[model samples]
Structures are given as C-alpha cells and as structure tokens.
Target: MSETNGAWTWRLEDTSGTVVPVSEEYADQHFASQGDAESWVGEFWRELAEQGVVAVTLFELDRQVYGPMRLDTN
Candidate 1:
C-alpha cells in the first residue's frame, strides 16, 4: 500500500504476503457514491473472480493532512 498526493493505493496480499492483482479503481469505486463507479468496481471484481481468484484479502493505506491550528483574536 502506498499514498501519493491525495490518492491512496492498495493491493491484495495472499496468506504468504504476496502481492496480487487488485484494481485500485475498484477499491475507489467500491466506496464511491457514484453509480457508474460502483458498477465499474462490480465488473472489476467479477473479472478478477473469473480468473480463479477467490477469498482475497484487502490491505489499505491512507494519507491525509494533519496539523495544528492556532487562532488569534484582535
């Protein structure tokens, strides 16, 4: 898993910790509120499953802005 800019990328790993092919768009669309995006993710997952992939586990990494803020009153 890796994060760059404001995008996050995640990959599915096997029990032995091996990287497997998982669609980033799928993950995004899986959580997306858009109907088209959700459909796309569904297709992606279907394709992956057709390739004899079963019982895959997802690992995720997220990045966000965090800082301290201070206010001054005049």
Candidate 2:
C-alpha cells in the first residue's frame, strides 16, 4: 500500500487475501493517495465502536471500494 499527499489510495489484501481499494471516493477525493483516507477510516471505525457496533469488516478491490464492508454478529 502506498500513499501520496496525505491521501490513502492503495490496495490491501484483506483476511481473505483479496486485494481492494480503501475507498474509491476517498481515492478520488485525495488524488489517489493512501494516508488521509486511512486515517479517516480508522476514525470511522472508532466512531462505530463508540456507538456500540460490535463487528465490522471493510472490503475493497483494485480501485474499488465495496463496504463497511460487512458486519458480523457473534
């Protein structure tokens, strides 16, 4: 994963070993960088946790943003 200009626009393999984008909108918003978006995502998750959301999964694809990406119970 690589970032440019404090924006996150990289692909990472999830636990499933699938490579995907952190977020498409973020990529576009940040000019295909991979820092700012990641930071935001971290915060987003944190907020969800604070809201009592138990499980969350974030998914992506090569330049494709696909999720929260999934949520699980138990």
Off by over 4 Å in 2: 1-32, 49-62, 65-74
Total clashing residue pairs per candidate?
Answer: 0, 14
lDDT of 1 by residue, 1-74 (tens): 12233232223334344545655533332222234333443445556544333433322234322211111112
lDDT of each: 0.35, 0.39
Q: State the weakest 10-residue window (summed lDDT) of model 2.
A: 54-63
For residue 21, model 2's alpha carbon misses the true position, in angstroms, by 20
| Residues 1-74 of candidate 2: C-alpha lDDT, one tens digit per residue | 23334333323334454543444433333324334455655655544434344333332324354443432333
Where in model 1 is the C-alpha error above 4 Å? 1-6, 14-17, 21-39, 55-74
Q: In candidate 2, how many Å is residue 72 off?
A: 8.9
Give per-residue lDDT, candidate 1, residue 69: 12
**Model 1 — which ten-residue stretch has the worst lDDT?**
65-74
- Quantify how close model 2 is to the true structure by its C-alpha RMSD in Å: 9.0
